[model samples]
Target chain A: MTESWLRLAPGFFALGALAAWELAVRGFGVPVYILPGPIAIVAAFLTDPGGLGGSLLATLTVTLTALVTSAVLGAALAMAMAASRLARAAILPWAVVLQVTPIVAIAPLVIIWVGDPFASLVVCATIVAFFPVFANTATGLAAGAPEYFDLFRLYGASHRDTLLLLRVPVALPYFLAGLRISGGLALVGAVVAEFVTGSGGFASGLAYRILESGYRLEVARMFAALVLLSLAGIVINLALGAFGAAVLRARDGP
Target chain B: MLDIVSVERRFARGVVALEDVTLRLEEGNFLALLGPSGCGKSTLLRLIAGLDRPDGGRLTWDRGRAPAAGEIGFVFQDATLLPWASAADNVFLPLRLRHVSRAEAMPAVHDALARVGLAGFESARPRELSGGMRMRVSIARALVTRPLLLLMDEPFAALDEFTRHGLQADLVALWREIGCTIVFVTHSIYEAAFVAQRVVLMTPRPGRIFREIVSTLTPGPDLRLDPGYATLVTSISKTMAAVLAPA
Candidate 1:
């Protein structure tokens, strides 16, 4: 069907590019180490998926753990900021500082301080993911319609009730928007942290696999590891997007 | 009975919103505070509802004790329904805030929605409803608590004439049925004359009562076409024009 073909257009382009790359490498007599073709990368993936699979899973676990931690901690901080002006004033500047500081710059110090490579990577990733959620949720909490505040106050609603009923619901859309941004950032942070830690030959996440393959002149295996990392990032973003859409539908009802 | 004794309100920016306003509201009386824009009509209502404090005068309810915010039902100019909530959930808000379970509040919620003629639309969100329907939901939320004093600020000013008329009739019927004191605020002369037993006309800057018009005809569909209602409307309109005209 045309509709189905149109939907698969991106896939066709990807396949076409791979075919062209394979032809170019073979046609040009390029060496396998410097410029491996798509076929060689696929062969590498098929040959040792067991080892590659373990590394992919490890990277994915750290990425997901960091994302969840960021969301929970960020939402709590946002709520606290909404509840008290003093807290907002005291905490907001530090959050901004964390956001502006490059994760790569801090990764070395974090690795040294934490000692455990996994914890260090998670802390680095969480630092990267926290800002978007915190800023968006804080803005959303304060963005409640003025009429709603008056209505709640007229009803003698307690502060707890106002926060729970009015502020939280108002903050949902903004928080979800932030979550989508945080999802991709979390993955990027994980890979960057892993790359920094892998330089010391410590762990077995996908970044380390890529590093090891590069060092051993296994260009095909490195590309395969890179492919897995890209796939993980795409999956994280899509899953977060789907979850946000579901929550919005639920809020609006049928 | 509610008494407002020389109420004075001044905003922080040195703008006088209300000045030495004094009025008394009897139990079960349907009164309309009719005025032009920026005339402190809403300011006075806020004072009565205890949403804002008057700088000078005192407001005393029955037995010289002011009613708590929970005891007064206030409706804003806009519908102000939580867009995220269903009509039933919106109506259940006050009761829920008082720690009433949803199951326990269901009957009262249903009753309030029914009173506003929104019986079957309980599951609909505010965005799903028409403007009139949304306003009805707002009224339902205000009425769910069954407060003895109802304060409405231009509640139907945004609706079409047909919907406004329909709501006005329904409001009169509900008022008669519930016997709650309603202090309705509006700029519409017809609306004031149509629904209220007494219309308190107000002047513009630092608003104070300019004139009081009492309708002798009872509120009903026939009252709209009645010669008496026309005369009352004309008199109130003339008074408003005179008061609002720049000297």
Candidate 2:
């Protein structure tokens, strides 16, 4: 029973906080405009979920696109860095520079240059997500046990063979870890890009819905959109967590 | 047969790892290079495996040709199996590198694992096995290629005594059955005596051979308790101690 209590602790705490919030709003007669209660937010969501759902889908598509792009590009760049010193010295610094520069600051320029709202958001998000994967994978590739390399060389394994068989497996856990972090960063970048672009269209995401709700003083609806955005972030993280666990478990061989 | 005539190796940092190290290895003989750490025993093994080249001296084979890439199999001090691969995949690595398809190599891989007593462990990962079992997988990997020469660098140094002795016996049996020349490097005196037909004692710092003793007692399960085995271990230990003594 104690073990079960410990396992259920987090869920209970979240429920308690929501109940307290709902009671506090109702007990104090807090106006919906100042701070919407949990019940009011649910009422707002039930009023017109079609709009909120569309926004959620739009943001989700951008987030997935950015994440997949960063993963592929980051892994390829890391492999290049591992394979050649010249490539590492030449390109890795630029990647670091992109990582250090604030994505919000880059968002405007990316939007203007790409001229397509969706593509620009993807570019911005990819920049945000790329560094963790690249840096982690490079460290992993370089850290391969020296003795394993000697064994590969003894077998006369080609450079390609060593990279694919030896280094790739060694880098897998690190890469998966980076993927989980990148998944969250990709979502953050997508939202930030959406806010900066301010592209008023039928395909506008949750960021635009939040902005539009704030302007109209629809605090309850704004909270509903905010809740959905939080849910989206949680879903992305959980999905990536599942993926990383599955891949890293391969080390255990079934 | 392989000949190492006066091989000399010195690192660029001016550490003389070997000086005039000369030895001849007869095919199918089990030999141990026994010495303290930093005695260039591993360096010499690397030279034989062609993983490193000597700054001096020549190596010639009986076939009058340099040993081809696939002609040598090396086991490091660690099992060194790919953590993500199954025991069978790890054993099949050398043949895979030679471009043999997995289906074509599965039979030989299974046979190698069976020889190492890992018959039912074809799909097990390195982490799933105990230390002794992992070392057995390493041995199976080394034997899979059927190399003419097998070089092991303290492969059992990390295991407990019981596991070490068990592996030592297995190695001897494998050697007799497989008929490959083995040059095992170890710092253990009894291990050298128990496993090798000839134990070569090496001195520290710019390691050179101090002596080579040939064991007359036949290797068997009873050899560890036999008086002859104890005699050989004592004699080898005394020689090793003298070399390890401060000048």
Candidate 3:
């Protein structure tokens, strides 16, 4: 019973905060154009569900696509680097360089060069999220216990078998940790890129809606879009955290 | 059968570990390499196990043929159980590595654990078991493969006297039942006397066999605390003291 109550505490706290914010804004008679109340944001959200929903869908699709691409490509690169000392020496510095270079600076350049807004945003997000997975996996692979290798040698295990059975299993927790970190990074990268490049033809994401509301001086709607983006990021982080925890628990067993 | 013909091993940086070691063991015999610290007794066991090669001389088998792969099982001073695996899973490691499925090796694994008096502790993790139990799990793992030769390097040296004695008696029974060759390395005079059919006493560093004492007991549980056990222990202790005396 106590554990269940503890789990629900965060939801209750969020509700209280929202109630307080709405009361304070209404009591102060704050204008909708300045600091909108929670009720006004909700009203704006419900007023045009189709427009908000479309933008939310667009942002979700771009972020998830970039996240999946980064995970697969980054993990493969990490494996290749771990497999070859020469490749690690050559490629790891470039991966670091990509990580440190801000996506905001690169987004406009990518948009101009790639000639496609959506593709540019995805490339930017992939760049942002790739390094954590690569670095963590490399460390995990290299950190396999010495005794396990000795056991492999004693049993005459092949190189492939050693990697598959021992090294990969050992590296899994670290890789999942990296994936959790990258989940939020991918969302941030997508929104930041969209903000810099301006969402293009056929679709606009939450960032573009936020930008459009700001230009039109619809501050309540802008606040609503911002809230949606923040919620999406929080949800992604919490969901991935739960996923990584589940994986670790399963490996540990009952 | 295994033969060590003048095997001499020297490490890098001028450390001589073994010098001119020659010994021969018949099939299914129990031999203990007995010595104090830094005597390379463990090194000799490693050579026989083929974990390390001799620097100077060759080790050979009787039929002039190499032993089959997985023909030797080794138990280190540490239990060396994989921390992530359950006790039964750890025991099944050797079979799993050989491409034997868990279902096929399950009965043999159970029997080996039973032989070590760990019949129903299969699901327990190593961390959950006591010291004696963990060592039994290691012994069971070593025996599960049914290797032609068992190489144990001070396997029970870390255990308390009561646990060690219990294991020594259990080991004698297991060896008699399994009928496999064993080369055990230990620094304890009492342990060597208690367990081995023949104890090969060694000199200090750059170890060579100083004496070989053959026991009179038949391979059974009655070997311990026999009347002759004291005399044999005294003679081996004297031999070790003389070997340890200043050059």
Give all candidates' CA lDDT scores.
0.90, 0.90, 0.86
**Which CAPRI level is candidate 2?**
medium
RMSD of 1: 2.4
Ranking by TM-score: 2, 1, 3
Consecutive 10-residue window with the lowest summed lDDT within model 2 chain A: A195-204
Per-residue lDDT, model 2, residue A77, is 91
Alpha-carbon DockQ of candidate 1? 0.63
Give the top-scoring candidate (DockQ).
Answer: 2
What count of clashes does model 1 give? Answer: 0
**How accurate locally is residue B95 in candidate 2, as Cα lDDT from 0 to 100?**
94
lDDT, candidate 2, B1-247, per-residue tens? 9899999999888989999989999988999999888889999999999889999998988999878777898999899988888899999999999999999999999999999999999989888999999999998998888889999999999999999989999899889888899999999898999999999999877788889999898987678999999899889988777767775
lDDT of 1 at B41: 96
**Per-residue alpha-carbon lDDT of model 3 for B1-247, expressed as tens digits?**
8778888989988888899998998898899999888888988887786678899888889878766656788888888886667899989988888899999999999998999999999998888888899999998988888888888999999999999988999999899888999999999998899889999998867788888999886655666658788888999988878868776
- How are the candidates ranked when ordered by DockQ, highest leading? 2, 1, 3
Q: Residue B48 deviation, candidate 1, in Å?
A: 1.8
Chain A TM-score values for every predicted structure, listed in order:
0.96, 0.95, 0.92
Model 2 ranges with Cα > 4 A deviation: A199-203, A249-252
TM-score of candidate 2 versus the correct structure, residues matched by position: 0.93
Q: Can you list the residue pairs that collide in candidate 2?
A: none
Candidate 3: segments with Cα more than 4 A from true spot: A1-34, A81-91, A112-115, A200-203, A248-254, B3-26, B33-47, B53-57, B77-92, B100-114, B118-137, B157-164, B186-190, B198-247
